[model samples]
Target: MKILFMLRDPFYEAYPTFIEAARELGEVETLYPDRGIEKAEIIKEIANTDILVVAKVKIDKEVIDAGARLKYIIKYGAGYDNIDIDYAYEKGIAVTNSPGQNAESVADNVFGLMLATSRNITKKDHEMKSNHWELSVGHEIYMKKIGIIGFGAIGKAVAKRAMGFSMEAIAYGHYLDPLAAKELNVRFVTLEELLTTSDYIIISTSLTEKNKGLINQNTIRLMKRSAYIINVSRGGLINEVDLMEALNQKQIKGAGLDVFSAEPPQNALPLLDNVVATPHIGGATYEALVRMADVTMTNIKRYLAGEELLYRVYPQEVRK
Candidate 1:
């Protein structure tokens, strides 16, 4: 059995263990490409692969069909939208993710973006270094309305930090559990209500068909003009063009985004002063990488051992 490890980077902590374990199962070849490989190249690369381990590279229907020897596909993180999960499952290929492995790391980054945008921290720092020392007025997180969209592990993590700052936090999730909400000390509110009321909105939801382009023109209009929007989730959640227009028009105060529709932004968002964008490094901490490495390789081992899988998210219908 051969395993082709298609990695976006080669920095996972348990890298040697991953290779050794795969060798114990069968032959293993790990490929780390700085640029995303094309579909034809991927098919050629994984021609003999029995298991495919990857990061955020796209594995569409063509790739899944071309994966003739693929028995399992393991993702490095929680989100698997980049994979054609349903079709792959239909082809009898197993898929798994390391859910919540990097939740706290992402939550920390979310709070960082929140504070940066709310207080103009990045702008002020730039101005100071450029020899302008004028102070920038910013709002406090204390006693303020903080809306958390997508109240999963990452969202709850942010809520915990918000509590430290004495912020009144509310949350909205498709999978809302009354007990969980109560435990987190967050009230459940409708998306509309959250939009209208929150002073700082942190988006931590996974991307789905229902919520794609969620924070669009109408939703932006619903938010307070002074409100700040922060997203640490997938870039598709917000309409980038709409967001830019809103920022340019001062529709809302500003936005702090760690993810964008096109990473490296195929556009001019970074050039905008009000928008603070990072290279999607919200969950790139070393600790998170280690946890993710452990979880992912463990799942690969599980597949070989015929044990029950961990953090399985695909084929929900079949699981039911």
Candidate 2:
């Protein structure tokens, strides 16, 4: 395994012992955070890679084809949209991801963002620091109706956390079973109801073909004028252009976004004062880093032993 890590930055002391073990198995190299490299350079660097590992970088068909000896791709988190999965499948390259590894960490970030926007915490802190102490009344989140999209591990965790705040949590999914909804302690609702009813709506779903740009002008109109949105899922979930127009028009209250349609957005997201945006770091905690690495190691051991890889992504239908 000639492992190549296409990571933005070092994760959790670089997971020292894991690196040592992988080094024993085969050669390992990383294209780290600070250095700037073009796609052509990236293609050149991965020419001999047998196992390509990544966190945030996009691995298109060009990069996959450039890796003449590529065998496997291990995404550090649950989402695999950054990779051209069909092309890699055609090339016979195995694609895997670390699901549920970062669930708790991401849930924490969702709450953090939620509180920040709802209470105007960041704005208040800025005002106090600048010696301008005008009282700015913020909304209380207690007993508020919260709607969570995509009732997966992260959504369930968000629901559990919402209980501590005394908030009512409802969830919406396309094919949610009644028993599963009962177990999660969330009442199932339609997408339209969730959007219209919730005081705070959290996007915790993955980006699928049907749901990309799901939160558009018409859906935004369905929301209450004072309602807020918290997105910790994929960037493509919301339409940035429509969101910007709504923000300027005061159609909705505000947003706390951890992801964007285009990373380092080339649009009006940064210009809005009401929007609190982070660099897509919903699950960048040290715990998440270690857990994902552990899961990846399990897959590597399976690959070496001629066993089925856990959290395999490509072919999407094969699950055991």
Candidate 3:
């Protein structure tokens, strides 16, 4: 089998074991298209590939058509919105993603942003470094209410951590599993209720066409003026313009964003004192990378062995 691994990160260098394992299965060709490689070049590279592994690269219809021998497309992380799974399915290409592989790391980041934003950790640190002994009062998360927008693996993980802070966890999602919520002691609530009541509102859902700009001006208005917004999921989930306006007007207390509407955002949200932003690194921890690599390799091995694949996402009717 010939495998094409395309992503900006140097995965093989960071995890030599993964490349070694992949080599055992087939001939592996890794591509580092950091500055956006041309589509024609990508088409040329994928011409003979049997298995394709991707991170954030778009696997649209054109690229799918170029892969004459492609059998499976494995997303290195949880989100597969970048890939055109519908077209791939029509062409008999199976697509899968490593869901929950980085849930623990992302959950940790959610709290990191939460504590930093709520307690003014970064601001105070900056002041102290500049020889100013500023005493800015900050809010405590203890006994506070946290509203989770998506009750999936990452959302459940965040709820589990909320328990340590003695915070009330409530969730709003399309697919809220009652048993799972009960196990985590998370209450189910409507979106408006979650927004109005939560001290910290977190966006942890996947990005779909139906909910692309889920958090907009109208939704922001529903939130408490003192409430903070935290997002560790996809950037497209929130409308950046609306969020910036709300922050500027003090509609919300602050925002802790790991993802933005545009990566390396063109806007000034990152420069705002009220916004604590990171360059979408919620799932970039070493531990998360190891787990993601394992899941990717497992699925590849399963496909090669003609066995049942885990975390199959495409061909929705046959998803398992």
Candidate 4:
């Protein structure tokens, strides 16, 4: 058996334990692709591989076809949109992801971004470092309304955290579980209501075809001028150009973005004084990395032993 790990730079160093365990099962090879992996190179490396472990690399039909021995594709973290799920399914390649493994890490990041943006934490720190003492009025999240865009594991975790701050939590998602919301003390609301009413709007949903660029000019217009947007999920969910314009016009207070429409965005949104941006590190904590690695390894072992796989991603789920 052969296993290929297509882990990108930085991430390649995050899973030493997983790599050590995989070696006990098969011949393992790990590649640290620069920003994006070359398709031809991936095809060549994956040709004889029985399983492929991917993070941030796009696994499309051409590469899938080249993986003659491929039987499984494992996503290192929660988001599997980077992989071509439909194509992999068509090729009889079972795809699985480590959901909830990074929920706490990402949920913590949600507040980290929220507090930093709301309180001008980063801005004040920069100013202080420059030998200038200035005080800026910052918004308080206490007793404020927070609208979560997705009601998934990460979203639920965020809602749980909101309770500690005495904030009201409301969520909007394609799939809503009333019981879950009731337990978390979150109310389900329409996208418009979430935008208009929330003091802090959080995008914690998956990026899908139906909702791509969901946060555009029209949606931004529905939000309160005092409101702020914080996205810890995929960048494609928000239209960068529209967000930049809204931020520039002060139509909205500001934004906290960990993910961009493009990784290392070519735009000036991150450069804006009101915006606080990070390089997609919502799930980069040591604990989360270890949890994700453990899940990935368990699924691989389950697949090898003919046991039921965990977190198996279905085509219909992604299509919706």
Q: Is candidate 1 or candidate 3 better by TM-score?
A: 3
List pairs with backbone clashes in candidate 3.
none
Worst 10 residues of 4 by lDDT: 8-17
lDDT of each: 0.85, 0.86, 0.90, 0.91
Worst 10 residues of 3 by lDDT: 7-16
Question: Residue 273 of candidate 3: its Cα lDDT?
Answer: 95
Q: Pick the candidate with the highest lDDT.
A: 4
Query: For candidate 3, lDDT tens digit of each residue in 1-320?
Result: 99999865655557778877899998999887666688898899999999999988889999999999998999999999889988898999988999998999999999999999998999888899999997788999999999999999999999999999999999999997999899889999999999999999999999988899899999999999999999999889989999999999999999999998777788998889998989888888778888999988889889988999898886545554
Which residue runs of candidate 3 sit more than 4 Å off their true CA positions?
315-320
Candidate 2 vs candidate 3: the lDDT winner is 3
lDDT of 2 by residue, 288-320 (tens): 888988898888888878899997785545432
Ranking by TM-score: 4, 3, 2, 1
List the candidates' TM-scores in order. Answer: 0.94, 0.94, 0.95, 0.96
Write down the worst ten-residue block by lDDT for model 1.
Answer: 10-19
